[model samples]
Target: MRFYQATRFLFPGSLRLRMLALCSVGTHIPLLALAGWQLATGRADWPSLGLVIGATLVGTLFTLLCIDALLAPVRIATRAVAALEREQTAALTAVRDGDLLAELVVGVNRATEATKVRIATLDDAAHRDPLTGLLNRRGFLTRTEAARDGTVALIDLDRFKAVNDQFGHDAGDAILQDFAAYLARGVRRSDCVARWGGEEFAVFFPETEEGEAAGILHRIVRRMGAGLIDRPDGSPVTCSGGVVALDGETIGQAMTRADAALYAAKRAGRNQLRVSDAHIRLD
Candidate 1:
């Protein structure tokens, strides 16, 4: 048996063909040796020896044909698995019902779907703020690349420390969440609102001019002065904002100018918007 198995290395073909070759060699080699010994000893005639050789050749051909037919389904299944690994399609179209290969294909499709869902969930968590559900500073920077030629605004809540002190931290948290929602609602679909840090937020308006962005901020200021934002103790919430144009300026430079303008707004009053002229060329 071991010698017959070793015959597989002599042939270059699929496992089915190699197995057939091994079986044929094992059977014929022994029968031919027996006939040769019988004829030399005058125990078998030439006619009987010819019959033995012809029978062996016919049997080998029949066995090889059967092996090829039996392995056809296995070859198709192998190709289907290769296609799935390449991410072409999830379905194994050639697979039939009530077979082990069909079950394996279904399991593979389910796993692929699960992997896709997990990746999406992780991406959302990475870009979102946990407390207010707004875009975090990193997310804001990543999504605001298209605002390079538009406007950037930095907003700071006025007297927000007093809110945290007068009320509780929980009340302060509620105010922040409500204010974030308000900012989102006031902006257009092309605009982005992000929580810059504690008590501060950033907005980016893509393809918008400085004056137009300032006008929008002014509206937000008027709304704040109207006491629209609700608090736990019925107190009014107000915010100061600074707007700057992104013309020929890097994001860092734009943010610095906007921050300076925000301080200017705070110094002038608690509820107003300031426009920065830092990027203006005197030429």
Candidate 2:
């Protein structure tokens, strides 16, 4: 019976029904032929013919019942596939012992579950910054490195600790957010800018030299120092920066040298821009 149901999958459902009906007639013809031979040999009576008809009817009914039982699995499979198409997480719940169709449905459900989990993992790996959505340190590094040959600058906001010390961490956060926005707009689209870390920001100029980067930084310092950031009491905000060219050892090394110059700027005055001396690389 199980084998017959498994074979039914190879045929259309309507054709399967017609085939089963034909099987019933085929089964009856052989029995009728045997009964006719017995009556012809004078070894059977009309009563024998009646017995043959009854047996055929009973056997046909039994075969049809078995076929219907086997079909239960097919019906369950069709419905389960429909649910899977609609819900994406549907599983086979009507499995019977010794049913191959039931096993196939269970396997499909397992594959679907695994696929959903993998997709979610990939999605998480894409958009999120490995460090912080505050833009990862790597993302900033890649963008700055790709900029056309130009001057690069690093800026540090002065006296940033006073906010954290006097007003608490909340005020420090607000200040950072405000400063980040201000810095973003201060540079040109051709330039790259990023928040390096607490109170420090870096800028890159495409197709520019140290002199050009220094000039831009000086203008920005004066603008910011002249009370560019609005506050309740109008106390001025000041920044110090260092500018350098890309013609040195490496981008990282150039940044390190720029930091030294930035320290020099901060030591000289609260608001200033200092350009680092150019260093020629042998390699």
Candidate 3:
């Protein structure tokens, strides 16, 4: 057994070859020992020895071929497992029925699917706002890191504190959610809207210039001022916004200018849009 174990490296790195080598070694070792004993006792003739050796060799060859045939399914299953480990486009659908390999394939597929679902759930929770179903501040910042040129808008609800005081917290929350939905529907799919904080929302329009953004903001302001959003007591709910063009500035700098413009709009009246003229330094 020790000699057989040491000679394993003589065979190729294949399951079939290793099995054949082991079968041949086990059959020939005992025959060689018996022939040695017969020669020492002077009972082994050349013809008889040659015959025995030839018959044993033939039997060993036949047994090795049978072993190779029996292990062919195992070799296929092993290759499938290797492909999966390498992330190659291989499917284990051809596993034999009621076999251990079939059970392994099913288990592996289920685990992969469950892992994908878990990752998606975690990602959604991390990026989405719980109340408004929009992107939160963190998610927005992450997305805007790649933006080169566009428009940034900061919006604030007019007299939101009065609504919460007169109606209730629930009503205030409902108003925020409704405004978020309205903003989402008002913009293109390429735009991003985020809840920047309490009573404040931020929007990013990618690849849009100042004039285009101003026109869009004006339309939104007019639509909002026409009493489209209502309070519990049938009062009109309005919002003030500040729009600024992205001119080689970071998102943080653009947001600062927009916020300043938003407050300026709030001071000017209460339901209008203000465009910022802050010259962005191209750093």
Q: What is the TM-score of candidate 2?
A: 0.53
Regions more than 4 Å wrong, model 1: 1-106, 278-283
Residue-pair clashes per candidate: 0, 1, 0
Q: What TM-score does structure 1 among the candidates reach? A: 0.64
Q: How should the candidates be ordered by lDDT, best one leading? A: 3, 1, 2
Candidate 1 lDDT over 1-283, as tens digits, reads 4653455354433455566767688669967897979978989877877888888888887887787788687667656655545553555554444343334455467557756777888887888888899998888887875456889999999999988898888989988998898888888888888999998999988889888888887787778778878566786798998899887776667888899888888887668888866422111
Sorting all predicted structures by TM-score, with the top scorer first, yields 3, 1, 2
Residue 17 of candidate 1: its Cα lDDT?
A: 56
lDDT of each residue in 106-220, candidate 3, tens digit only: 5467557656777889888798899999998888988897787999998899999999999999999999999999988888899999999998999999999876776776777
Q: How well does candidate 1 score on lDDT at residue 125?
A: 84
Which candidate should be chosen as best, given lDDT against the real structure? 3
> Which has the better TM-score: candidate 2, or candidate 3?
3
On TM-score, the leading prediction is 3
lDDT of 1: 0.77
Candidate 3: TM-score? 0.65
> Candidate 2 lDDT (Cα, whole model)?
0.67
TM-scores of the candidates are 0.64, 0.53, 0.65
Candidate 3, residue 139: lDDT: 84
Model 2 residue 170 lDDT? 74
Model 3 residue 30 lDDT score: 76
Candidate 2 local lDDT, 1-283, one digit each (tens): 5765555554333534555666678778977788888878977777767888888878887887787788787777756654555545544555443444445565567657766877876655553243323333454566665554677777888888886787687766766677667776777767766667788877778788677667766777888888886433357667888888877455666688878878887777657777765321101
